[model samples]
Target: MIEQDRALYRPLWTVSFDEAVTLVRAGIAAAMRHQVKDLLVDTTALRGFPSPGTFQRFLMAVEWAEEASGRIRLAMVALGEMIHAQKFGVTVAFNRGLVNNVFTTELEALAWLDVEPGKGSPTRRQ
Candidate 1:
């Protein structure tokens, strides 16, 4: 399941990657439709880490499907502290043309997204 939250005026995606490929593809498509440049993704409910091949495929999908004109920054909050390092490695390795970071908490992820160069606050807290 995937849910989009615009609570803080930013598009935060809380996605369960049980069906990794399908949910991920759908999320990307939805982001494009919403013209989301800086997206926070919560992937803490995934059953398991994606294999190398699957990650590669996802990377390719992003390169091919995303717009060519603008930068897309993604801050992904992983499942847990133990898996955070491993997931961060995957993100670094496959982050072709995107600014992707893995975090253990939403606060950290949001902070990272806020400081990205040229990316001002699209969302504000009440």
Candidate 2:
């Protein structure tokens, strides 16, 4: 169950590239719908991304996010392998004027997003 504490969002997924895109788009739209400025997205279980298209996939997600929220802080919790060594994808997103980053743990993402643990109501999606 994906939950939200204030603007904090936590969703776990193991889907294909296409499904991931759909989720990213919907997730950002949902955060915007709730008027969230700083969003913490837990994607630690996110999987099935095509090996060679990770960069392009991330670009699409970031673009969708930008279209959804304009300027918003996005923190994501994902597996280590999903995190680029140089964080190039993150850099690209940040370069596009979106405050974005990826972490290996929820705590780290929450800290980055400045969201307190266990505070506010969680709004579940799907």
Model 2, position 63: C-alpha lDDT score: 74
Model 1 segments more than 4 A misplaced: 1-18, 48-70, 81-95, 118-126
Q: Write one digit per residue (lDDT tens) for candidate 2, span 24-75.
A: 6677777777766766767666777753266675666567657655446677
- Per-residue lDDT of model 1, residues 1-126, tens digit only: 223522122223443333554554455556656766666666555555443345554554354234322345555565564243345343443344455556678898777766745453322121
RMSD of each: 7.2, 7.4
Specify the highest-lDDT model's number. 2
C-alpha TM-scores of all predictions:
0.54, 0.72
Evaluate model 2: give its lDDT. 0.62
Q: List the residue pairs that clash in candidate 1.
A: none
